[model samples]
Target chain A: MDEKDKEILRMMQDDFPIVPKPYKRIGDFLWMDEVSVISRVVKMMQDGKIRYVGPYFNSAKLGYSGQLMAINVPEDKIEAAANAINKYDEITHNYLRAGEPNIWFTLMTPNEKRAEEIIEAIKKELAIDEILSFKSKKTFKIKVNPA
Target chain B: MKIIDERTEKVLKEFQNNFKIETRPFKRIAVKTGLTEEEVIAIIAKAKEDGIIRRVGIGVRPALTGFGMNALTAWSVPPDKVDSFGEAAAEIQNISHCYDRECPEGWIYNIFTMIHASDREELENIIKSLSERFPECPYKVMETLKELKKTSMKYFK
Candidate 1:
């Protein structure tokens, strides 16, 4: 990505226009044409640099409870556990980190009861004994501005 | 207030991630939601104003942008020191996400911060700077071995 592309990314992260011609607004700000701005964004998306340009909805305000969960799955059962965890649409991020709790995932359910039910079901199916769930007591910062 | 009418649901489902990246993008969303471009813009604006939509923006991968080295650095702060720890960690720009999480049984790490840097040495330095502030609390860096599944949450589906 060139400097112009980086500039576009920096601006978009802070404030992406919500109007009909959002790209034009960005182009005007960056001193580039609308077509050039759109093409560059498209190229970045195709190159896997930019995931997508979309709205990030607040799941909490949408009445969803979120939790961070870590499970200590045996090496032999890692694949099975991952497959099982990925089946649930409610689980947004599932990762294999280097630690005792090898498998970590984030769960967002419509309510706390639903989240518990899913966790219980996973434990029963996989026979997982060592697990930990960390619910956010307070959020100090959550900003993504990478260019 | 939470406003999830039928039309709003349709709009969200269509443009959550698959937003059109062209001129008059909202027009396409309007077509999908059976509303005019103006109505679609109004819906998004209201959602943003209501704190339901955090931002209409792009998700840039730090790995591709030379900030690939990232990990969840969980700190074992004392019960009384979590608030101060969070405030101190929040001031640093490298720490994108810092939160006070509920500490369950068998785990002592109560505060988690996602630290990102261009290299391992840089990451260690960032950790060192933070640890200097609270020498009493220990920390652990759980490096990500692999991403099993990472995707945006699809609501109103």
Candidate 2:
């Protein structure tokens, strides 16, 4: 990404305009055309400079319960376990991190009980020993931007 | 102008509830909300600009993607260095989230860092290096055990 791309990203990340002509608004800010803005954003996504381009909502306000859960899975079984766990729409994020627990993922459900139930199901189905789930006690803040 | 019209509200609510992973997803939303494709797109674009909505993009399940080792590491940097430290920490590619959070008296953890990657050893190494860089500041690692909820905040409802 060049300086112009960086500038465009900065604007998009900070606040995307709410107007009939958003690309035009962005273009106005950057002194570029709407077509140029739209094409640039598409290009950025294609280039993998930005993983996503959209609104980020505050999940907690939506009445859903979420937590970061980790478990110890054998090196050989991670892919299988991940595939199994990822099938659930509730599992927003699943990742293999470097830690004692090894496998970590985020589970979101309609309520707390369902959240626990999902974890238990994973534990039972995966037959994984030593499952540690950390329910978020408090959320300070979560924001993502390209710096 | 209030960016959210009745039609827009309906579409936003649907998007919030069901983020379908399909081709031409917005068209589906338009069908449900009784708005034209251009109208739906316009409302979403407007909502995003107003900050009433944030991003309309894919929500990656990070752990499922193999970038899972995540933790919130807090450090107590001297007041003078907090800004630079935050900038430095933010510059790191692996550090996804960085901020200045409130800390208790004499146990201030003013600087916060989030490290996400596939390897624990690498995460530890990065933390170790951070500790070295800010030798005076005490730090603690709070690993996420379970992701209880990971949905976006829906304001319209």
Number of the predicted model whose lDDT against the real structure is largest:
1
| Model 1, span B1-157: residue lDDT tens | 4557777777777778458788888899898778999998888888889888887787777788778788889999997888899999988888888889998887888899988888899899999999998999899998877778877888866
Model 1: per-residue lDDT, tens digit, A1-83?
89999888987885899888898999999999999999999999999888867888887788887889998887889899999
lDDT values for all models: 0.85, 0.65
Please give the TM-score for the first chain of candidate 1: 0.91
State which candidate has the highest TM-score: 1
Model 2 TM-score on a 0 to 1 scale: 0.63
Docking class of 2: incorrect
Cα lDDT tens digits, model 2, A1-147, are 577876777676656554445567778889997777777777766665555544566455445666656677778887778777877778866656544556666677658787767778887888865456555444433555322
Q: Report per-candidate DockQ.
A: 0.74, 0.10
Residue A120: error of model 1 in Å? 2.3
- The candidate that wins on DockQ is 1
Model 2: residues with Cα > 4 Å off, grouped in runs: B1-9, B13-32, B35-95, B98-113, B116-157
